[model samples]
Every structure is written in C-alpha cells, then in structure tokens.
Target: MISRKIILTFPQALLDKPIVYKLIKDYNLIFNILQAKITPDEEGIMILEIKGASRDYNAGISYLKNLGIDIRPLDQKIIWNERKCTHCGLCVDICPTQALSFKRPQMKIEFDKRKCIACELCLRICPVKAIEIQQ
Candidate 1:
C-alpha cells in the first residue's frame, strides 16, 4: 500500500466534478480529506491523505492531473525556530495530533513530523514567531 498527503486545487471547470469520488470508484483509492473549500463554479480546494495500492495511487493522481487539478505534495513541513521558541507550550495545546510536545525535565518543545497533519493550528497559536511553514 502507498500513502501520501496532498493539497489539491480544482479549477473553475473542475469544481463541480466529484474528483475524490472518481479516485475511490475508479482506482479503489482511499482519500481522507483533512480540509476543504468549495465555491460551486468558482473553485474547490482540499487537503487530503490518500492511501491505496501503488498502481492505483499513480492512476488516481494522473486522473486529477488530466483534469487540470493543481496538486501539491503536503510532505512539505513547518519549521520550528528553536532559537526563537520560548517554550511557552501554546503550540502543544493547540496541536490536534499532539505532534508538538513539551519535554518535562528540560522544558523543551519537541516536534514529531510523522504525527503532524499540516493543519497549521500551531502557527496561529504560538505567541512568538517560531513556527513557519516551509515552502
């Protein structure tokens, strides 16, 4: 099986299409949507975690690409500037996945990339300018 996190932007023409449904019906892929915005004929955007067989994954992505969907890998990450971090732990509190944690003894913030869903909540919650989305 293969899994990937992706951000998809649907053009105005593709906004009405059931793109995610096509992935499931045609490629047998599992697409877990983390976030979405749809504006009828204007545009559609989604953050999704897709899992399926390798061949199916490839085919599903190809289908989206053919439909003019803008797809970006969500593997891009948030960078924590330790030097600027104040160990306030605001990020830890707002992290839905608990990907950010404070170590008790040393009072240091730790980040686990695997547990993060790229929700960007921590970026908003942090008091200092410590969390930055790496482009």
Candidate 2:
C-alpha cells in the first residue's frame, strides 16, 4: 500500500463535479480530507491524504491531472521557517494535529512534518510568521 498527502486545486468549472467520488469509485482509493474551502462559481482547494495500492494511487493521480486539476504535494504547500520562529509556543496551541508542540526541558518548539495536515490554522496564529502556505 502507498500513502501520500496532496493539495488539489479545482477550477470554477469543475467545482460542481463529483471528482472525489471518482477517486474512490474508479480507482479504489481511500481519502481523508484534511482541509477544504469550496464554493460555487469559485476556485476550490482541498488538502487530502490518500491511501491505496501503488497502482491505484498512480491511476488516480493521472486521472486528476488529465482533468486539468492542479495537484501539489502537501509538503511543498506548507513551510515552517525555523529561523523566523521564536519558540513562543503560540502556534503549538492552534495546531489541530499537534504537529507543532512545545518540547519540555529544553523549552523549545518542535515540528513534526508527518503529523501536519496543512490545515493552515497555525499560519494564522503565528506571531513571527513562522508558518506559511505556498500557492
């Protein structure tokens, strides 16, 4: 089995389509939606974690690409600037996934990339602009 985190951008024309249903029904892929902002007649963005056989996963990605959906790796979208971080622990409190946490004894902040879901909550709460979302 293979698992990947990806961001999908849907054009306005495709906003009403059941694209995610196709990923499950046609490619037999399992998807977990980490974040989504979709509206009628507007572009939509979704952050998802997909899991399936390697073959199915590839097919699903190709299917999306063929339909002109813009896809990007989740890691490329969310960036944590270590140098700009102040270790104030403000972002740690807002992280829904606990991706950002305060490390004891050292009194420092820790980031676990694997646990992050790209929800963007930390991006809003960070005082020093340590977290950012790349288009």
Candidate 3:
C-alpha cells in the first residue's frame, strides 16, 4: 500500500467533474480530503491524502495529469518558522492531527510534516505567528 498527501488544483472548466470519484471507482483508490476550496466558475484547490496499491496509486496520478489537473506535493504548502515560535503550546492543542506537539523532557515543540493535513488550525492559533501557509 502507498499513502501520500497531495494538492490538487482544478481549473474552472473541470470544477464540476467527478474526478475524485473516478479515482475511487476506476482505480480503487481511497482518499481523505483534508481541505478544499471550490467555487462555481472559479479555480478549485484541495488537499487530499490518497492511499492504495502502488500500481493503482501511480495510475491514478497519471489519470489526473492526463485530465490537466495540477498536482503538487502537500509538503510544500505549510511553513513553520522556528525563529518566531514561542513554544506556547497553543498550536499543539489546536492541531487535530497532533502534527504539532511538545517534545518530552526538552519541552520544545516539534512539527511532524508527514502528519499535517494542511487544515490551517495551527496557523490561526499560533500566538507568535510561527506557522504560515506557503500558498
């Protein structure tokens, strides 16, 4: 099995298509939508974590590329500024996936990028403005 987080950008012309559904039905892929902003007649952006057999996952990605969907790795979307962080633990408490947490004994905060879903919860709650979206 393979799991990866990706960002999908849908052009206006593909906004109403059932692209994600096809991934499941045709490719046997499982997807979890972490965040999305879709507006009629406008560009759509979504953060999704997809899991499936390695072959199926590769095929699904190829299908998406063939359809003109802009795909990017989710790791590039979120930025954590270590210098500005105060380690107040506010973001740790608000992160749903526990991507931000306090390290034991050291009491320093740690950010696990793989576990982050790009939900933006931490961005809103960080007192020192340490977390930001990279666009």
Model 1 over residues 30-117: C-alpha lDDT tens digits?
9888877553335666789999999999999999999888888876688888999999988887676778998889989998888987
- Expressed as tens digits, the lDDT of each residue in 39-117 for candidate 2 is 3336677889999999999999999999999888877557889899999998886676789988899989888988887
Candidate 3 per-residue lDDT over residues 1-135, each given as its tens digit: 999999788798898899999999999999999877653336777889999999999999999999999888866567889899988998887676788999999989999988887766567567788999886
User: Model 3, residue 93: what's the lDDT?
Assistant: 70
How far is 20's C-alpha from truth in model 2 (Å)? 0.5
Q: Which ranges of candidate 1 are over 4 A from the true structure?
A: 39-41, 78-135
Off by over 4 Å in 2: 39-41, 77-135
Model 1: number of clashes? Answer: 0
In candidate 3, list every pair of residues with a backbone clash: none
Off by over 4 Å in 3: 39-41, 77-135
- Clashes (N, CA, C under 3 Å) per candidate: 0, 0, 0
Worst 10 residues of 1 by lDDT: 36-45
Clashes of 3: 0
